[model samples]
Target: MDTVEVVCSKLVEDADKWRAAADGMSKAADAAGGLAMGAEQFGKIADERGVVSAYAPLQQTFTTLASGAATEFAKIADTLTLVAETYLREDQAGEHAMRRLEDRL
Candidate 1:
């Protein structure tokens, strides 16, 4: 039971870290999109026709992929938190029942 608690605690900690990482990923995606848009306005070469236009699809795709990855990370974090909470609840309940039986004995 002690071991289970320790494991659950670790799971919760990992979940928190994952949540933070997801936030960072989302922020990075936003920043990247902004940079790409800015570049499209200022970084065009005359000879390289259609180069700026080509970047539009790439930027959109990158942003979409990053957003999806962040969503998955958040989902995983939520799942881990739920699992840890459930385990802790069950452990406490079992301990409580055991104590009651011991008292009767």
Candidate 2:
């Protein structure tokens, strides 16, 4: 028989860090959105189409990337937290079972 040990606390700690990263990404997404708004306003006053054309695509791309990164980071954080919780629950259940078996002896 082999024994395996899992550091569930470590998993949860890592999940918290991932969640923090997600928060940062969300802030970036907000910043990108703000820039897009400013660019839209500036485009209205600009005489040339080149500046507007260049910034429009860039704004859209940045907003999309930031939003996507936030979503992915959040998913990673959630998964890590869930894995840690599940492991902890199962370990407790096993311990309880062992205690019950010992009580029967």
Candidate 3:
């Protein structure tokens, strides 16, 4: 796969990992009313990385498009990346918040 596709695939993979981590965190947080002592906070890194992985090139794509340097496929990729990034950032922020809570607990 091309670099852009490869990056997106990795981001998607990382997003899945983050989603799993978020799921586990939700369960733990629900059970403990937050995180228990010694519990590791997870997902934030993956989520954030996933966002960057997925969107960095997307922004690039748009920039290229606006500058008339992008082809149709690149525009499509950029659009997809923008949409994907939206979700990824939300998840990342949630995970980050969880991490902060864990740290405080």
Candidate 4:
């Protein structure tokens, strides 16, 4: 037979780590948002070769990518937190059941 143990504390710790990463990504998103705003400045009609339209396309792209990544990371962190809490509750219930069984025996 094989045995396995689920450490709820470790899951919570991992969730914290995911949350930190999400925060970092959110900061990056904010910075990218500033860049996105700046990108609008490049859409002038300076030359016929379209040299002035370089960064205008990125007026929404960079911010969207970074923001999406941050959102996904946050979701991962929330899922880990939920899993940890659920496992902890289940473990406690199982332990209580075993104690009752032992007391009756």
Candidate 5:
């Protein structure tokens, strides 16, 4: 059906957008981790209380959290792409079967 085709097209488009967003999220996470480490180094140079040592755990925690978030984002993007492709394939197959039946009639 034309409606099914249209819906599938939209789904594929949305999936592509999601994939792009996931990539952006990963880049952001990487940048954040780099910035946090840089800040830790800077703190060590400027502080007497061994701030870097004290803050190392917090920085590591943030990096880990960001990494986890990026991983989940990638997984979500993959799922969206797979679901869109599957729906489009099924819709095309049904249309093809209908055409064959129509020819027999």
Candidate 6:
């Protein structure tokens, strides 16, 4: 669980960095000359690219989070399953012991 939390935190940090990169890209584009399509097309592409780039980070974050969560959940599930099996075996043994005592009486 602690590891999961750390991974999640790291993913968030990466997301922030990705966002900053996209923003920087947008600003640089804005500072450059007008679009070749008489300004309108260029402006549109720039705006669209900025927005699209912004989502790129979000998409990456989602993918990372999802994959990590799945892996962690699998591990947790395996642990729980092992615990359950152990308890079940113990219970079965106890039941058998009790039955044997009853028969001896």
lDDT on C-alpha atoms for all candidate structures: 0.85, 0.84, 0.53, 0.75, 0.73, 0.54
**Cα-based TM-score, every candidate:** 0.81, 0.81, 0.31, 0.77, 0.71, 0.43
Model 3: how far residue 46 lies from native, Å: 42
The stretch of ten residues in a row with the least summed lDDT in candidate 1 is 38-47
**Cα shift from native, residue 15, model 5 (Å):** 2.1
* Residue 81 error, candidate 3, Å: 7.0
- Backbone clashes in model 1, listed as residue pairs: none
**Candidate 1 per-residue lDDT over residues 52-77, each given as its tens digit:** 66777888888888888889999999
Give Cα distance to truth, residue 105, candidate 3, Å: 64
Where model 3 places Cα greater than 4 Å from the true spot, the runs are 34-105
Better of 3 and 5 by TM-score: 5
- Candidate 4 overall Cα lDDT vs. reference? 0.75
For model 1, the superposed segments whose C-alpha errors exceed 4 Å read 38-48
lDDT assessment of candidate 6:
0.54
Candidate 5: give the clashing pairs.
Answer: none
Q: In lDDT terms, which candidate is top?
A: 1
lDDT tens digits, residues 7-28, model 4?
7667778889988988988898
Q: Which model, 2 or 4, shows the larger lDDT?
A: 2
Question: Candidate 2 lDDT, tens digit per residue, 1-105?
Answer: 323234777787899999999999999999998885444566665626467667878998998999999999999999998998888789889999999999999
The parts of candidate 5 lying over 4 Å away from their true place are 36-50
